[model samples]
Target: MDEIIRQRIRNSKTLLGPFPNFFYEKTPDYPQALFLEWFQVAVESSVHEPHSMTISTIDQHGSPDSRVLILKDIDNEGWYFASSSQSAKGKQIEINSKVALNFYWSEIGRQVRIRGNAVTMNKERSSKDFLERGKIAKAIALLEKQSLILQDPHELEEALTKQLIKLNRNPKLISPSWTLYKVEATEVEFWQADKERKHIRLQYNLRGEKWVKNLLWP
Candidate 1:
């Protein structure tokens, strides 16, 4: 069985792409600009869930944990994402503000990695983001028992029904635990894969108010 599994894994192919060329020299002064460009191309290429990314946070035990989440927004303030303050990732962020975000568009053989410190946005912004969510999403967030054990499935349904009714009575209801966080990136790396095994990696590092770009060997 072990030999069979190993053979299966070793036979698998990767980095297969009519991949786009990365002319790192022609990249923008800021990493955000290049990120937006690459993101747009991924969208145009019909990549699935192009806005989805893996967010990694350190747990209380000093271990790494990661999960996939949707990208909310991005700007000079950095990448935006929202979650319940009571959630595992949120609690982890509070303990250690440092985090890492990774965006991989496998179809295009491209990836972007960001290392940064996350900070909570203003209350108004967080509230606005929560209100924009669909009713079901808002109801689930109101429960605020994320990453908790579920003893019974019926309990969830009952709780959700109650929350939905509460929303109907007060459409403006918002969860205080729902928070929007922005990651202020210290370094952003862009990687583009080549069919011939050569890969291009461009990294932008923030130093004193200016961004310094460098090439990394693949």
Candidate 2:
């Protein structure tokens, strides 16, 4: 079974469609602006979950850890994602603030990688975000102890029932540990894959308060 899975994966291909006419001429001029533009294009193309991204963080032992997370927001402030302060990712960020984000839209043959520093959002803003979340999401945040070993699966189920009651009583209740983290990008790379494998790689580095752009070899 393992060999079958490996063979299928190894034989699969990418970038098989007729090359889009503008792809060859397109160059990343402004990193953030290009990102927003590409994101909208992905949406128009019906790419599923365009705002989902993989975030990588360094654990205390210097090992790398990563998980897929929904992108909450983006602007001149880099990117935003939410987590609990006691979550595995949150603890890792506390030990080391440096992190990376990866966005891939296979339907568009595009990817964006960002390396940056992460900082917790202010309490008021974090609270607002929590309040905006659905009741079930709020109940999960109230759990606070994520990624923990469970002796029984029903433990969380029972806890969630109690939390739902609490939320029903006070919809405004907010968990102190639920936090929003923002990444301030120091380097951003935009990649576009070509059928011929001569991929485009454009990188932007933040220096002082400005961004310097450079083209990278395929």
Candidate 3:
């Protein structure tokens, strides 16, 4: 590992700080509302790719995999994103509905962690979402074989060309197995940046089918 990583690890082993910024936490009963406020702020600010989040999943062999994916939708129910059912993350969700999602806006030094159960939306809904995408996205979707092996780059390019030609002929055709899945959070954590080292952390938990809030250490 790098020397900087080693140094950071050593620093983490100790508690040292001037500690002060838990004061920005929002008022009672609306943790999600606070998240919305921060998200809106991020959108209006200069932070690039604010919608990108780390999607954590476990493979069939139990190894955890995490990669950044753009957020597609958000509502009171949860966050949504679409993928091919054959993709590794998609397959993992099918095998185990439980997963974690993390959003970190480093420019603003804010982060959100969500633990939830994923539910695949209906086929029609998935198709509608796919159809609504831009032409380049649609073309790329038709080309990339998510999580599948590609032996030859030229072969893959040829396949993409063929698919594009087909797409040009009839743009209405939707991938038979495309899917949109939503991660319905049972727990959510909101963390805000600190001027001093303290930072602000708030967590919401689903207890007996109801959401309960609690403060947490930074």
Best by lDDT: 1
Q: Which stretches of candidate 2 lie over 4 Å from their true place?
A: 1-3, 18-30
- Model 2 clashes, total count: 0
What does candidate 1 score in Cα RMSD to the true structure?
1.4
Ranking by TM-score: 1, 2, 3
Model 3: what TM-score?
0.86
Q: How well does candidate 1 score on lDDT at residue 160?
A: 99
Per-residue CA lDDT of model 1 for 11-44, tens digit only, reads: 9989878887788889999999999999999999
Say which prediction, candidate 1 or candidate 3, comes out ahead on lDDT. Answer: 1
Give stretches of model 3 more than 4 Å off.
1-25, 28-30
What TM-score would every model get versus the actual structure? Answer: 0.96, 0.94, 0.86
Report the lDDT of model 3 for residue 28.
42
Report lDDT (CA) for all predictions.
Answer: 0.95, 0.87, 0.79
lDDT agreement of model 3 with the native: 0.79
Residue pairs in candidate 1 whose N, alpha carbon or C atoms collide under 3 angstroms: none
Q: Report the C-alpha lDDT of model 3 over 124-152, residue by residue, as the tens digit.
A: 98999989987666776777578788898
Q: Please estimate how well model 2 matches the true structure, expressed as its whole-model Cα lDDT.
A: 0.87
